[model samples]
Target: MENYYVFIMMCILLILLPGPDTAIAIKNTISIGKTGGLQTMLGTCCALLIHTSAAVLGLSAIIVKSAILFSIFKYVGAVYLIYLGIKTLWGLRNKEVAVTDERKDEDKYGSKSCFKQGFLTNLLNPKVAVFFLTFLPQFVNPGQDTFLPFLLMGATYTGLTALWFIFYIYLLNQISAFMKRPRTQKVFEGITGIVLIGFGMKLALEKAQH
Candidate 1:
């Protein structure tokens, strides 16, 4: 029970810290509103399930043990993030003023694309897998019943992620009205792009501990 409490606290702290996941969630929220934000949140949660399952099954251990495999995943994640960032920045640079008629059309298209955008954005991110392998084991006691601990940890992480994303959706939705302006949208996209690139660089440079 005590361990569970500690695990919960740790998960909260980790979620509070800014990362690619949080940035992506916030950007999606600002760009497309609550539904889009929720979709991204669900997608991220699905990725977490995959990571947790891999960790529990000890596939994370194999990936962590093989330097080559680890590097491959790391580079793939880095490149994908960088690509997203560059694309966002490019979009910002090319943004044109929307006429009144075009604004309505954009809104229609935006609503429709929100889910797929959110889903693919998170689904393509490989760093999520690396994060699970690197971070989840810290609170785990190998001496304890390993499977139970892993299960508890996975549950804790999923809960924390859900709570955080829900809160983010609520808060961003309130501000989303103001963010509908062209300038606001461009600025948000630019910031998200820069942050994603930073995350990619950090992941690319991280060294594996033997």
Candidate 2:
């Protein structure tokens, strides 16, 4: 029971830590509204499930043990994140006022796009694979059938993540009016871009454990 409590606390803290996931969520919410943010959140949750499944199935262990595989996943995820950051920053140059009604329709991202962004960002991060591979096993008892325990813990973590993001999305929506202002949106976009790139660089630097 004590271990379970500790695990829950740790999961909450980790979820609250700002990363690519949070940056995307905030960006989508401010730029596209609550529905976009919800779509993104759903995508992230689905990615978490995939990671959890991979960890349980021993696939994550294989990736973590192979240095070459780890590096390939790491660099790809890093480059994608960096690309997203650069793209966001570059888009700032094209003033929103210059967007005509037709252009606006063409330029706007749909629900699928937001969800995909969330899914790929979470899915591509090898660190998430490492996390599930390492973090979920500590709570299992010796001689226990590990499969059920691992699934339960993974589900718990996913549930907590979903709950937290829902609350976060709601809070952001409350401030949407002020945050949606042209100047505020630009400033936030700049900040989000830098944060995503920083996370990408950090992920790129991550070393595989022996």
Candidate 3:
């Protein structure tokens, strides 16, 4: 159907748009390697799946209606983003000093840590819940069974997301040699740090729709 085609196109465009996920993917891939990036991507996709399930079950509807609940998730998400930004910037300072193996191990996020960062970054963001609630239902025909359509669309979105991130991670890896230079890493990390903080502040200021 034409509507389905449009939906797929929209999904593709949205997937390509830059966001915290992209920033983290780029950060992890450059810092830890492709494996880290994939782990982060997996975490994010899992979060997306949960959001989809929540949306289908009408859980997101409750969050939308309650301003208090909305704020709790929003602020938590925003605070976490800001925390990540600050941690990134702090790492820059640590670069100047000699780091022991133990310190290096601590500085370098392990797989589980990276995965958790990706999961929580996505899971805590209420806007994602909002998106699924508001964005996915428009194309469904009225009076039709909604469950199958929702699941299908959600799975499509998730698959598209994974594909896009895989390509993105590969692209980042391709130029990783240049990106790994000391000067370049410092500059890239600083910019991403600021971007994350900016996103967090912006999200904090976001108003919940009635």
State the lDDT at 93 in candidate 3.
88
Give per-residue CA lDDT, model 2, range 1-210, as digits (tens).
Answer: 128888999999999998899999998887778887899999999999998888879889999999999999999999988988898888788847555762455347556778988999999999999888788878877677777777888889989989988999999999989988989989999998888899899999989885
Judged by lDDT against the true structure, how good is candidate 3?
A: 0.86
Give a tens-digit lDDT track for model 1, residues 75-185. 877777787788778867656745665457646775445555445545444555566667766766666656767766777788788898999889888877788788888
TM-score of each prediction: 0.84, 0.93, 0.94
Instruction: Using TM-score, give the best candidate's number.
Output: 3
Q: Model 2: what TM-score?
A: 0.93
Residue 98, model 2: lDDT of 57
Q: Write the per-residue lDDT of candidate 3 for residues 1-210, one digit (tens) a residue.
A: 129888999999988889988888887777677777889899999999998898888898899889999999999999999999898888898775765663467456567777888899999999998888888888888787777788888888999999999999898889989987878989998998999899899989999987
lDDT of 3 at 46: 98
- Provide the global lDDT of candidate 1 against the true structure: 0.73
Could you tell me the lDDT of residue 88 within candidate 1? 75
Candidate 1 structure, TM-score to reference: 0.84
Better of 1 and 2 by TM-score: 2
Q: How accurate is candidate 2 locally (lDDT)?
A: 0.86
What are the clashing pairs of model 3? Answer: none
Backbone collisions counted per model: 0, 0, 0
- Scored against the true structure, residue 18 in model 3 reaches a CA lDDT of 92
